[model samples]
Target: MEKIKNLQHSSILFGILFLFLFVIGSGYYLLRKNMLQNHKAQREIIVLDIQTKVESLLSALLHSYTLKKEEIQKKHKEVLSFLQKCGCDPLRLNLTPLYQKLNANYTPPRYNIYITDENLTIKNTTFKNDLGFSLRFAKATFDKHAKEHIIGVSTPLLEASTQKFFSYSDSYIPKTDKILQLSYTYEASSQRFQKIQHFLHKMGIVRATSYIILNDGFINKIDFATQTKEKLAQVIEKNQEDAKKILKTLQTKSRSIRQNKDLQTIYFVVDSPILKDAKVLYSITFDESDFYLKLATLKIVFLVITLFGVVGIIFLWYLRKKEIKLSYQEQFLRSAMHEIQTPLSVITLNHEMNTLKTGENEFTKEITNALQILELSYNELSFALLATKQEHKVEKLSLVEIVQKRVSYFKAVAKSMQKKIIVESEDPSCIMISSIELIRIIDNTLSNALKYSDPKSTIKVEIKQSNLCISNKGKKILDTKRIFERYFREDSAKGGFGLGLFIVNEIAKKYDIKIKVNSTDKKTTFCYHFKEAECI
Candidate 1:
């Protein structure tokens, strides 16, 4: 009877252990499966969202191009009709009104308008001195072919006589069939691109990003909102090769998306064949890191939760068998504190050096700037530690003076980039706040402006009666909602610790200052309100 009881107890314990293993294994498998499904769904949504945005932006661009093309075609037709009705020969017809209209209202990327006779001789032109000149090479070919067909567009090619590349769109008179060719040259260099660059920056797109409108081996026009020499060369080379492949691909495929070999980026290409025998290719690239960062954050949260769950289960199992350990947490805190102190010490040393009686030279300037950057980095880490420790101090002080001091310090850095700092204040009095806390707020805002603003653009610093504003002309701040969170950067290529704005918010809260951000495709503004405390 004793042997049988012992056997039964051992069997019961084995059964319970087996059940526990099965339950844990099943739970883990299900959780992993669900997480994978969620990841897949999120990827699909991202692709779809990006596609939609590209399509909308492309539509707007094409619509604007089409409107200009149509207007030119309409005016060309009107001129032809008027000449025919007046019975004036092409060579003899006065085109001053037409030239005036073209010059006043229409400024296409390249090539000016010209009216020629049936014999392929230029009769009149919008160009001041080109009137009465004979058509040559591509222009002559365009005239000859246009006379035969009466209505069509020319292929992209350079004109020998004029030494210019042109695209001609022609219209035929119904009964007479007299052809009128409206020539547009491909200059590629125009102020329109500069405007587009500014627009992209305002939209919060990275400055290093670029766009090109290309056909075949010939690049009609290219736009670079922000470009370094290396980046420009890379883009030119890549596009030269990619344009050929893309053109060929368009011939076979409707729409295609692919990742570059580096797998760090993605490109979406869309081709639309338009009315004038022209193909418009729209290509956009999105940084893979942006999407990956979001995924990483989610994964981190999942891992943390999993770790907690595992610890809870282990603790339940060993409650009567094991004692708790507190040394690990203490060690982590100590290590973190040590890391924080090192930077602080460097900042203090640098600050002392900067204030010393040193000569004002390039080296001194560079060192001072570096020291300021180091200080900002140190402050960010310090603030993070303080938050984790749940220690916050609030004080009241003059907000205007804080902003002014930051602007003064940042002016030197901005000047190095050939950028100017402009300040406008409604009140020149004191604000209620702690100096350190206020410095934290201003430092983050100004540092962001200096780091991201266009190299030679002006950063506007405005202080109204109750609000403090800082505006910069650069890439608009992307994901403004999460920009204040730790480890968030609009462009990963711009290396930063990403805790600046996060600390800014912490300091703002400690001082009871309300912060607001507004951005568009041309400018980004961050405003701080001090309504609670009146200006002294």
Candidate 2:
């Protein structure tokens, strides 16, 4: 039966441990999986962001290069220099013919030159509506010391009067209080996509190599190595396989391609804004070795922590099994004590009544003394159980009375052990405490004094108004402080659970009582000072 019970307990504990470990493992796996997916998603987002930025930059660069914006700006500067050299008159020049000759091709000319007078009012201009517009409110400065003041298209300004997206360059005419300004229009952008071109330009990625393949066997490649645009035939000859794969993928509408080996490369295809019926393939690459190394390190660290947790669980399981064994033994002892209580009371009552009816004999006296020892042990164990499991009732108990009663109760046991119990009550006083707790305190103290005293020696128990002291002559305690610790026995042959003094200390602390122990070669004394006591 015991083997079966032990096996059952083991099975339950192991089942619980397995369940706990399973939950931890499952949670760890789920967290690791989630972290990997999140990392991958972040990498994808980065590649996509790079693709968009590169595309925007390339588009702007292509537009600027194709339109020869720099050449036109140089021409505008020369024109401004020529106008500055003219120095004709005060508001007399009409620059309409020059403007018409410059803007003959497009309906809305790309560049418009305007001159401002001392009042910054447009005195000579091409656009008729801006004949008298002031440049003072345009946030453009015409610094006389500087040769030119220019604002780039990155943070383009709107014409105050025409609301056109244009950038301007102005030169102050020396000694004339006049400004020669040239303005040019660029592409319009909504608020959302306004800053991409500016950011790319700031990063200086326009000079880097770029490639864009289309469906109609057209490949536009910007090669920074030669600083030239590679034609379709040249690009095909250089990277035929890659070009073919890109073209085929674009045809099949499978635009997203990723390779995650030594080099993590991502190729994305999106519709081109600059070309006709064409898709642009953007490739982004990253070295994934560092990322994988960190992930591996994290796994190793987590495994180490899991190993430690497993060891801790096993250690706790061992402790729990030991506790279970002690619990079973305690349960059996309590059951036996309960069964013995009835018979013990009957035997005690019958023994006393028979002694009263007949004459006293040595056999009856010995039985009586044995019964007293049995009752002492029974009381200790019974109180140990009751103290843990029961709520006690508080009452005013006379310390003197309780001490005298316990000392008298233990007199027979002391007599049987060839020891004498001597109690001195200096002050008869009462204290507010639980009766059972007070009795246990007195019983345990008296019992210990008797148990540890020298044979045929006197055990002295001193009682005062607020204190109790029990002293005995025995093998001196090596460590007085440790004697009150539970399960700490100086001599195993003394036949005790070593709980008596521990119980005494517990009850003393309950009433704010201070315990003092003194041990020497001659005597060992246990003293309890009651901080709360009512004098009679």
Candidate 3:
């Protein structure tokens, strides 16, 4: 009977083990399949989103350019009307008054305005010396197309004679159908397209290409890529064949001539055909890296989800066994806390005893200062724990007074470090803020200023209406953009958890205050602009 019982027990254990292995294998297979499906779906969505965003961006740009062209045309018509009143004599037209009026009325700066005859000969121009010259040579290509079109603008081009870059062109058609071209030139290295380019760059496009097609089969290409002009030209030429293929595919898919294409080079081609009798195609191309970046981002999300699922299973198993280990964890935490407290208490007591015995000796004072710094650090840690673990109360108090008090508290430390704290104020009134938060923000700033300031130098504090500005002479920040980020520190030698500015930023944001920093090689200033509250 005993032998029979042992055999049954062994058979039961083997069956349970086999069931576990089978379940695990099945779960792994299902998880892998689900992950692959999710990744594919995510990639498709990303590609579609990128396509939509690029289309929208191109539409906006084209619309803006079109509007600008319209405005320029309207102004040109006004100028032509004024010229007609002056009797069609180019030399006697006297465009000075009209030029002044346009300069005052125009939204953007104007470069020059020119009037041309039926033969496209320059009759009169805003630039006096260029009058009666053949502008046809310089603007002939663009003028030939502009004569038929009512309104159009040219892309950025470098003028050979002046060696300057021009960004705009506007044409007017009078009753006689003569054309007048108004041009605008901007500084080459200015921030003209910075915002637009930055937006595109953030979307992960390495380059952008735009084409303005005239009714006469003339194309004006605008390359916004960082690549050199020659390299970009080569790239465009190489991709033209691909563009034609894509155009065919788009026409087939949408059943419309105006459609976009997705190519193998991760580039998107969008074509917009004007509805007018003289149809022109506006084509734009954008890099496809954004689509892939979004896919990679989704993949990372899937990985995180998989990790969490695994952790959840392990966590559940741990919880099931937690009751058995509860006493052990509690004993360990108790012992750890005791061990830490014992050494801290010993250090505190020893410092106190030394200070009392020596009464004002350098060694005693130094030890006392060190102990105070340690105690302050422990207080900060305790405050952080309390803040995170429990609800905090918001109490309205004067920000200026709280700052003063925090500065007073740090006076001794500043003195020990041989640094002076100076406060300058343009406002004597109080500003409302949370007392604890105000103290934390100002304390951190003051501490950092004192720590980094030259040994004998003074840290200046200025208070204007709704603004608190602090300045200190220290090493310039390497990356000023990331100064308020968590765990960001300029100097490795500076002893800090690097949480001070980040905490200050959080508190400032909570209070709806604005913080700005201005730094140079000589000095750095941190300014906090507080929101104005009702006077008490």
Candidate 3 runs further than 4 Å off: 1-346, 349-358, 383-386
Cα RMSD for candidates in order:
33.0, 13.8, 28.5
Better of 1 and 2 by lDDT: 2
Give the 10-residue window scoring lowest on summed lDDT in candidate 3: 1-10
Task: Compute each candidate's TM-score over C-alphas.
Answer: 0.36, 0.57, 0.37
Candidate 1 global CA lDDT score: 0.59
Q: How far is candidate 1 from the true structure (C-alpha RMSD, Å)?
A: 33.0
Model 2 lDDT tens row, 30-134: 878987898789776655665666566556645654465565557566766666688776367767666776677656676677778888889887766778888
Which digits, one per residue and each the tens of the lDDT, describe model 3 over residues 357-471?
8676887767666766665555444444344555556655665666677777777787788888887776555566656677777877887788777778889988876788899
Total colliding residue pairs, candidate 1: 14
**lDDT values for all models:** 0.59, 0.67, 0.60
Off by over 4 Å in 1: 1-358, 388-393, 429-431, 509-512
Q: What's model 2's TM-score?
A: 0.57
Which number leads on lDDT? 2
